[model samples]
Target: NNRFTERNRCPADIEKNLEYITLIWLDENIDDSNESVQMQRLLYKMNNYVLLYTDPHLCIDYIKTIVDENIILIICASLHELVLPIIHSLNTVRAVFLTCNDHLKLTSVCSEYPKVAAICTDQQQLIKSIHGTIQSMSNQTMSFTLFDSNKQNSTRDSASILWYRLLIDILKTLPHTDQSKNEMLDKCAEFYRFNEAELQKIDMFRTSYTASKAIEWYTSECFLYKLLNKALRTEDIDLLYVFRFYIIDLYSQLELEHHKQFRINNNWDKLIVAISWASNFKR
Candidate 1:
């Protein structure tokens, strides 16, 4: 159900656009005689793309090839060992490295090769950076949980809680202006999954459960819309009515002009329909 996993599948246009010139650097020693290699060879042969794999010891030679061809290289190894050689070789080509390390060494490496663009890291940093950037754009201050070693929790649970807290903190900083509220609401809808426990913990909802609680606590229908939409997508009927009531309330309060403005700005039919229904809701 993770939208991220679905979004990362390489599109056909990407292959077509880079078909003639792209090269994929893979670790050949992974399984020289396996179906994976055979399929890779077939792709290379059909598309005239380049594929190379070398032993960890012979990585320097591969680096030389990468530099000589000015090829976009993707290194399939720990960045601690590969960063030095890659920096030595390619002066201008783009590179992506897959790593599990928490060290920010890749940022330093990117500084050496300004052309060497993306350094894909673990999911935690990626999420944090994205949330940080969005909040910064709005000139809002938000705090994130720093998972120091002394925390009394399992690593997995701690990481999850940290991310959840970071997201909640960022949401709290969004401005009360309709434009800002709507933008934040849409973003929350896109990136977050709502849970009752998480909602109850917000300061605005600490008192009671009512239609007003959702709007007062969450600030906008966008979050409610997203929550209901997600619940519907997952067929979670139990939480549907809470979100449904909020959406109906938001629609009733907005003027016709406000609805038009929202539609023009967002261009999302689902949101438009939700707003319309809420605006026209009767007792």
Candidate 2:
């Protein structure tokens, strides 16, 4: 019954595990008495902190190599919005600690992600809150025999699907130059670990297009709507026909005020060509 004894041991020794805290001090310029520094010193004394002195993006890269689950992420307010998306994308984080006192923003963020349990600006309270959160997460994990593969796989697959959907939407709508497109594609490959062949499948003609086309499309669409209003105002059936069957059908899209300016400028030839180009646009 030695195995049983070990398994049933009281006051479990979590120190034997890979459990640790990740403290990301985002701002390079911070006072000595700042909560980030104070919290860092407090966590350092606990001997459980892994101080990351890197930018949010690079820090995320380092964190990606860690396959541990008991990671408690403590990030500054500036890095919160930037790093949080990456953190949520991973299934490793057990809890989150923020060095922010903005109750309104914290309340909204906490509501969005329940794992964000504490938003502390004071050193003493931050330490206590962190310790308590770690303890609760540790206890919760103790009840489980091991990592839940099914849950992790589900989370990962769902995230991948959403990420892919977003990229595909970007490809269809958001216009980017070749350089930007290639960079985005490269990043996607790196993030998803896809090889060249696989990346090629997603690349298609989407990345080859120019941003000017997208801008023109948006401006044309806005212009068409603007012209449609004018057509209605002057009871111009011919103008309505030109818009319905030609202008809008031919030019692609614009912003509100800019669209007004474009309409006033009467760039009818450009609108026609844009609409024609859009009509010929292929996936």
Candidate 3:
């Protein structure tokens, strides 16, 4: 009984507050006569609240009759019905809702008003478009090939360098299985030759030189791995010591990036393993 009393009182409170709030309820089966009477009374009272409940055919008429520019249009039936008029009246209105159809129309509307647009679609295309535009503009302004097809091919060259860096880093962590080690060496040599040949075709001396340097670094890393594995298997102290000294010397010569933590961790692991193996031989 108390709950029922409170519920009955709620509507009167809502009506009192309706003057300060704009409410629109849309439905196909709305009682038109009753709605018009109630809305007319509210208008006569200068309540400042607007309400519309009508089908798509009567939407334009319904919108014109409502005096409040600050109207909340609730779209309950067909989205096309709501979207068309709302878009037409874009100059007067602030916001809208389309609760029905999910189609390209929603996306088109949202694209026009991004701030109030809630339509969902393929976001990847939007992101790609933004990135491409920015990249193109930046390249044009700076006069650099950010995504160049030719002209030293900075992007591709940098990518190749990063790839070799990763391979070398991975090789240092993995334990030496003789067959796997041999396969790795063969692949390194093959890829290095392929990349070096491609770089030489570019006609940019600096790019070719950088590619050559990368090839040398990768080749040396592969050779070092093979030598380390061989020394470990044969318990050759002289060979292990020579490879260790060679690694130290190579480390000094390389202009490695400060952010190569992955490579540094792998190298540290390999160094520890080498030290352990050497101690075992001494014992």
Q: What is the TM-score of each candidate against the true structure?
A: 0.26, 0.40, 0.25
Clash pairs (backbone) in predicted model 3: none
Question: Which lDDT tens digits does candidate 2 get at residues 1-283?
Answer: 2111121122222122212334434443344445545545566444333444336765666556555435677777777888887776576676777876675667778877777768877667777887787556534432221123355357654554454334333333533345544543443344223133334533642444343344443233222223333343333444433333222222334223235545545432222223223333321
Alpha-carbon shift of residue 31 in model 2 (angstroms)? 8.3
Model 3: per-residue lDDT, tens digit, 210-254? Answer: 322432432332333333443443434444433333333233333
List candidate 3 segments past 4 Å from native: 1-21, 29-52, 77-87, 101-105, 113-283
**What overall lDDT, based on C-alpha atoms, would model 1 receive against the true structure?**
0.38
- Give the lDDT of residue 115 in candidate 1: 44
Better of 1 and 2 by lDDT: 2
- Candidate 2: worst 10 consecutive residues by lDDT? 2-11
Backbone steric clashes in candidate 1, count: 4
Candidate 1, 137-233: lDDT as tens digits? 2222111122323562887646545543443344335343445434433433333332333333332332343544442433343234334433433
**Residue 127 alpha-carbon offset, candidate 3, angstroms:** 29
